[model samples]
Target: MSAGLLATSPGGDVLVAAIVVPVIGILLLWLVRPRAVEWVALAALLANLGVAVAVLRTVSSSAAPVAYLIGGWQPPLGLALRADGIAAVFMAMAATVLVPVAIYARGAFGAPGERRPMVFWTMLLAITAALNLIFCGQDLFNLYVALELLTFAAVPLVSLDGSRETLKAALRYLVFALAGSVLYLLGVAIIYGAYGTLDLIGLASIRGPDGALLLAIGVMTAGLAAKTALFPLHLWLPPAHAGAPPAASAVLSALVVKGSFFIALRLWFDLLPPERAVAGSTLLGVFGAAAVIIGSAMALRQARLKLLVAYSTVAQLGYLFLVFPLGLGSGAAPFESTAWTAGALQLMAHAFAKAAMFMAAGLVYEAIGHDRIAEFRGLGRIAPLTVLTMTLASISLMGLPPSGGFSAKWLMLTAAFGEGAWWWVLVIAAGGLLAAGYVFRILVPAFTPPEEPIARVKPVVVRREAAALALAVIAILIGFLPLAPWPLLAIGRIAAGAP
Candidate 1:
């Protein structure tokens, strides 16, 4: 290892802590009595948030990728951990979404005496650990482990209610996810055989556009697309996401699927040569556009509130894939980097807004005893605060002005115009319109006066409503950020000679 690389700093240590601390908390919860688990989980999440903020400060000040070679061993011999601008941003986003979910779940999951609450907290921690690992992992094999951990952690959450329908959904998700793992593993094996190393930085230097490499990229991407629930491959997503508890649904839809998508982005842009990416990128984008149309249509037809939100997730994921064609055009331009950041910002904004929406939806269901959309005719009259939060979140989803969704759409539109890809621009506009329609479908009914005064089944806690509202407000506030490419996302570009 070079002397420059070995100069360890506090920033690097915090990167390790962001992942390790949550796992430690999970261990403590298992070891301790059930009564203490929720408090322990909340404390760990708060501490993890502090560490994430520290990491952001360190990276922003240094303006360099923070690297930590585990156990003092260098790459190829031992695992390495790294956080560049993108990783830090995502880590912070995850922490921000998680804290509120933790708070909301305290009421939804109930006291630690029940087995369900304990299991929910434990799985939440495991999911947190898995996501941190995915973001920070520098080795391909290590990332595979993290991906599997994420799957196992997330699958249980879908069936946490122990209902037959939820159980069926969990099984379907498990089967498809396992198949994805197989394909991804096969790609990893090919890469290992061809390049003799699975480290991302190491392979970036040696990988090329050969048949083996292309095949590996194709198989791996196909696998990840399934996990990401892109288009025709998204059959399992609606049921799984809608069946899970609201907190779990928020985490699953907002962040869990994103983990695989992040890996696919790294594989295409960082690992593969530019020329080889054209066909695959177009194919992915086609599916994405289809998802936007199909998922939104399905969402409009859904009867239940949570199901509608789940289908909306399917539609939203499609926009992420559109980045491939718009960002990396036939010829490069100065705005390419801007497009990349726009896509990332979209992911971040969606995470916050969707999580808030789902949590708010959950609170509504709790108050009304059911989630039937038609039956919620007077929801605003009963739980005005929760309804207000949902309205704010829907504005972001509909890409209204002064919201994060608007900022993301603006950048994506700019990229489309710059690249002469008018189709994507049309897609973005149509998606916004469709989003507005579906959001209004729900809100219109909620605002209408009921023939008879709707009786509230239960009273909602202010703190839970406040937590959901705070997240929605953050999503709206992100729009105020300057509409330019973020430098942090460009800090650790996968150059030809980095490894």
Candidate 2:
């Protein structure tokens, strides 16, 4: 292990709490009366949010990685939980999305002593703990365990309604997830056998262009890509995400897949020798490019609003892998590059925007009793707040100015231009145009006048509308941040360099 890896930082306990609080909440859910389940889940989520904020503040203020050695033992002998700037950002982002989702979920899963409610709340807290662990875990094997927990927690949410179709979708998701898990575990075994350690920092210190290490990284990348639902490996996402309840859809789309993607990011940017990964990075970029075009085109053709948003996820995820070629291939440190910051911003912006979009779709369904895009005439007149929420989210999704999506894509375009990778520039431009096409497909019809009067099947709650709108507004507000590579993102990274 690196010498610095031994020292535990002052606020490291916050990272522990970030993971532990949610687990405690899960336990309390079973112990407490069913009447208090919602309150218990909400309180735990709020406390976890506090821990996320504390870790963010501590990492930013100190400008270093905060490490918590398990049982006071160093790596190769024990485990460690560490949060760097990027981890802190991701943790806070997950918590930010979760709090509102818990609020929005109250309608569906708030009923006391119900089986679905019990399952939903338990899985919600499990997801929270799993995500916290994914963000902070330093050992590769430990992350595998975290990833498995995340998959198990998420699978139940997909089948919460207990419909035959939903059960099938859930099973399909499980199969894909298990396949990915096997590949990932095999890679971990390879790494451990070759290096005698699974600690990422220690592995980085002695990493070289060895065949075993390269092959292991390759296998691991493929596994994580499947779990992340990246293009060509994304057969399970649309059905699973679109079939779930509205709140579940938001959590799955906004947060779950990101856990696997973060592990992939660590593998490519943190563990591998930079020079050895360029060819593979370009290959991943190819997959990303295909995902952008194909996924958006598919989304444009979708008749259902929820499925459309889910396909949009596949496209948006494509933009993330572009960071590999744009940042890693630039000869600068990946953490310091414009593409890196752009990728991070894109992740944050998409999480907030997509969550809002899913919530709006759910509200539209609630009001009209269906989510068919063709029948959404006069949506603006009936549920104006919900339509407005969709509009705000669409702004971000289409990469319009003064929105987070715009900022991220703009930075990516700038980086591609600097690298003279005009193919990526074209990909980015086409993606924006295609995104506009799908987003408009939903909005234009909704705003159009109906042939006859349309009555809402149910009244939409003002607070739920506000919860979703708050997330959309945050997505827009993120655009106002300075359009530059952030120093905070590079803090505690191994490759801090001028891009």
Candidate 3:
């Protein structure tokens, strides 16, 4: 199937279930106590995972987008929910990561009768629903609604503890997200005025562009970049992502920002001309380079393990932007390029590896009463499994051999050399080194033989450690992806401007 090859395919109903299950769980959570809510949400998540897998299989089997136009009405007048190969892949990835996070959170938040656990479950399910909506949404306006829901669900998670610092971080995140919304909304209005359609597929059908079109795209990109916390606009990220509970931090760092970044990907890759995309891709790559440099350096300076992991997120996210210049060059099809596959790998690798690292950091905090890196001596002895999880995750993050990050960077470097974008190769190499520095900052102290057995804030829980380890293992498993680009990502990519 080529681009624009959507149909009202079989298994289209799964998309609705993927979204609706979480929403129903969130609603039911409000009326139930913690234990029932936990069981209900956990069961719903498992069903959602099954639905995600089904959607992916159906899309892969047919090699076409599965579209469910609301009421069977066409675009430009009616909304549509469409799942292409990319959406299906991301949906499966989200569900895969979320299941373990749910398990780990069950241990952290305690039994379901507590106020915080109830609220956390609600937000978690809500985010699951919002992310599904964003991925499936075929209309720009419909996606904006999904974005708003995601922001609302994510912001409160940062301040779950109600500490002054965390509250401030949440507030700061909210303000920036709101500004992004306003800018995005204005761009939507402009696009509708100029093109008379807010549907992605419909907009792609238009040929020539005017100033209004360019302006709308430009403003929309800026808005999304702010929401994504790319480079200079990333002031709110470290604090908010670091301040949240470990499970919440995992969601924010691993998946929440990806929501906006995915929209930006759709705008540039799916909607824009290849020629137009080149310039924007370069601009984004430049910012990405800066984020790698600055964010990595900041990560190395953090004395706290959680904050260090948070800044690593800033650095790691930059890797996604590098696909533009590297993929678009070398006279290759954009979707077929090594850089494109490498970027997708980078995203998945970061999600799993980073989630494992953050969860491990939380385990460290729980056992030791704090995450101060210098004081982590003997952690390796006290909580060997969690330490092992941290080591595996750090290896992935550092792009070490036999890890997903290693494979991704290797592919990207080959593409960079093939395209003569060797500058990015250097940037990627340096980012790895910085990642190593921070990883060392944690591991060195943690492995040091203690003067005496360290006092524990609490006994280490095996279930939580196993959950964290599972995520780390998944990150390593991604290293097995073939060195060549998989055909999966290219399933529905059509020529630019082809209606």
Candidate 4:
């Protein structure tokens, strides 16, 4: 069978379902009673998860990219939805994280009546649809639309509670995201004028090291970096993520920013030539290293639990950019496979672990009435399960043994050594140590006894704690996989000669 039809030519149908099912849920939410919104959202997400799993299985088993020609026309003339290995992995990750976020949102947002549960559900579904669209988009223009959808969906999530502080944060996020959109659109225009095509594969076939291409790449990368909240451009992240509700924070930190970073990865590694990638890779890595240092330090200084986790996300994103340097360098030993897999694994691991941690922290805040980290003493007595979940999730974040974070770090370290990029190895190690410090900052106080009788603590829900623990366990379990390159990641990559 041809590659396009490998999934019984059902790939396109599944892709559309993945994107449309959530959108349909969003529309249905407005028509349905508010009390039923959560159930509908959950059902839609579960269905999306099944579709995502099916797509992953089909792509991995086929070991090729799955393409769905829209309106029965081929690329450059018509739009297409395509899922390669990376896209499949991200789709699955987003689906996995959304399930827990949806469950958590039930209590946090409240069901129906007065609090506008329908609006929350609608935004959640919209966010899911946008993320899936970004993952599957094969054309640059289509991706731009997906990104706009994501930003709009995500902005409301920040201020779901309608608080003044959260509204301010949402506004800041909107302004910065708009700036990024303008820059990205300008870059897309340049690319279209230069190459007469916006399809990634089509452009890759004819791209050259010219002023137009380089200028476009620089503008696009900067724009994506802004959207991703990478390092120096992270002015809006800490406040926006920290101010949102726990479920919203988890999705924002864990998956939303990653949608843009994934595109940046594609722009450099898949679209640009090896020679062009070298200098650009180093520049990106330098920014990544700085983010690791600066973000980790900022995380350590945060007084609030949610704010600390939010800043940690800023640091973790830096690790993703390191892939540019480690994977694209020509002088590097042939460790591209390991670097690619490691970067991807880091993305997945961080998503699961961070989401769990944020949810767990939210539970803690609900129990304690506030999220001040220093005042978390005696929390273990009140909510052992939630605290335990936080600890487990932190283990992964700190890159300790038997957690996905450790596996990702080990592979990245190996790739760095193979390439003689000792500086990156040191940066990775430093980031881990800083992560340990910040994680322990919370763990120690939560586990320790209070100086006096604990004040009235809110009741902890068993189901909520279980939901958070499940995600943390999944993150830790991924570490047990063999410590080597992951073949699943390489499936469906564009062939060297393919357009």
Say which candidate scores most in TM-score: 2
Model 4: lDDT of residue 345: 87
Q: How many backbone clashes does candidate 3 have?
A: 2
Q: Candidate 3: which stretches are off by over 4 Å?
A: 1-6, 494-499
Candidate 1 residue-wise lDDT, 130-226, digit = tens: 9989988888889899999999999999999999999999999999898887889999999999988888877777666689989998999889988
* Worst 10 contiguous positions by lDDT, candidate 4: 1-10
TM-scores vs. true structure, each candidate = 0.97, 0.98, 0.97, 0.96
Of the pair 2 and 3, which is ahead by lDDT? Answer: 2
Ranking by lDDT: 2, 3, 1, 4
lDDT of 4 at 7: 27
| Alpha-carbon local distance difference test for all models | 0.87, 0.92, 0.87, 0.86
User: Against the true structure, candidate 1 has what lDDT?
Assistant: 0.87
Candidate 4 has which clashing residue pairs, if any?
Answer: none
Q: Looking at candidate 2, what is the lDDT of residue 101?
A: 91
Among all windows of 10 consecutive residues in model 2, the one with the lowest summed lDDT is: 490-499
What's the residue-level lDDT of 345 in candidate 2? 96
Question: Pairs clashing in candidate 2?
Answer: none
Cα lDDT, model 4, residue 320: 92
